[model samples]
Target: MSTDTNAIGLHTSTATQLAEHLNILLANYQTFYMNARGYHWNVKGNQFFELHVKFEETYTDLLTKVDEIAERILTLGHEPMHAYSDYARVATIKEDTHVSDGTTCVKGLLAGYKSLIELQREILSVASDADDEGTASLVGDYIREQEKTVWMLSAYLG
Candidate 1:
């Protein structure tokens, strides 16, 4: 693939790389969504109501993001990975097997959010290098959201 000399034009290779990164992001989003849903359903103790509602909101937003990320990958001319098997292979976030307390769940979510933010940072760097302004913008927005979520979850643990 040839590199575009124009600062505003994306190179073909960059576009392909962005697509791959988006696919991984999509998978992670699914994993996070499912985990959030699990926490929403199984969360117990005095903070159940608040944490349940928050987890529902987080999972719903992540569901929307999953679609958006997949669409973005399509826009970049790559097929989005859509199966559980595919997600399991690509996602950096792993599912929890046991239901834990609200505090434990919050801690777990914070760790996952941090991992996701790191992955997004790497993808953003590649997007910037490729001159894929659209992808870079998307990653930037996503990083902010993830960072906020991380902060909120961490605060819950304190």
Candidate 2:
């Protein structure tokens, strides 16, 4: 094998591809996180307390993943995108500007979670193919957890 691989022994090209996917994930997570925060603060009506707390918990967890994802990109010898502009340019999860209704916020969150899980699944496939166990495991855990979240959120909507 060529010594031209990255520090973790993955080829530069493979690492680059992984990093690219990771960067996109990072952007989406950041946007999702911000949206959760907005929901937590703005949500009103009968389910307000419940949804506000849930959104807070969700956004806090997202903050942690945002850090982990950036670190992973660094591990692959790439810089994580740091600007809101970069996130806006790349993220598929749109910002929630004015949603305050409890049910509406829940629906928005469900949509974001679904999108994140889908993107993570794609990344998991790439990571599995490249033998990047770290990336695979990270996103695999995310997928599992978010799948459950999706189910619960759907039940909430129903």
| lDDT value, residue 85 of candidate 1 | 96
Estimate, for each residue in 1-158, the C-alpha lDDT of model 2 and write its tens digit. Answer: 67779999999999999999999999999999999999998999999888888999999999999999999999999999999999999999999899999988999999999999999999999999999999999999999999999999999899
Q: List where candidate 2 sits over 4 angstroms from the true fold.
A: none
- What are the RMSD figures for all models against the true structure? 2.8, 0.9
Tens digits of lDDT, candidate 1, 14-133: 777788888888888889888888998899999898889888888888888888888888778778998999999989999965775988778777877887789889989998887677
Which candidate number maximizes lDDT?
A: 2
Compute the lDDT for candidate 1.
Answer: 0.83
Candidate 2 — worst ten consecutive residues by lDDT sum? 1-10
What's the lDDT for candidate 2?
A: 0.95
| Predicted model with the maximum TM-score | 2
RMSD of 1: 2.8
TM-score of 2: 0.98
User: Clash totals for all models, in order?
Assistant: 0, 0
Q: How close is every model to the real structure, measured as TM-score?
A: 0.90, 0.98
